[model samples]
Target: MIEPTMELGGPTGPKHRPGTLQNVVFAVRGQAAELAFRDAVQG
Candidate 1:
């Protein structure tokens, strides 16, 4: 799931403009951070 998205982000061509790919990356990273934070807090 995440691997494809990251791979797609490898090339910052015209299609992967500033906000487009960056937003997806940020969303994925944010979800990961939230999950990690939840785990840490639970622990």
Candidate 2:
């Protein structure tokens, strides 16, 4: 149940920008990887 969430600077600002979306994807992937590593270590 590890769900990664991204806040793209709220509604009405920069959320629809291509670069912003790319950044959000990268950020989410990084966070998910970090969480997975932690879970593997703990388990």
Candidate 3:
């Protein structure tokens, strides 16, 4: 299977990209886990 590439320039005047939903969720979860671990270690 072939993947699509972002157009350098077009009628829309380039695409505005953002992080994937899964990545955003993972980042939040990871930060929460890190904070919990730190709290456990300190307290």
Q: Pick the lDDT winner.
A: 1
The RMSD of every model to the true structure, in order and in angstroms, is 5.7, 5.4, 12.6
Could you tell which candidate, 1 or 3, scores higher by lDDT? 1
Each model's lDDT: 0.60, 0.59, 0.47
Q: 4-40, model 1: which lDDT tens digit per residue?
A: 3344434543255656766677657766776787799
lDDT of 1 at 21: 65
Residue 25 in candidate 2 has what lDDT? 69
lDDT (Cα, tens digit) per residue for candidate 3, span 1-43: 3211112222222234344565456556656666787799999
**Which residue pairs clash within candidate 3?**
none
| lDDT for predicted candidate 1 compared with the true structure | 0.60
Residue 42, candidate 3: Cα error in Å is 0.4
TM-score of each: 0.55, 0.53, 0.56
State the lDDT at 20 in candidate 2.
70
| Clashing residue pairs, backbone N/CA/C < 3 A, model 2 | none
Worst 10 residues of 3 by lDDT: 2-11
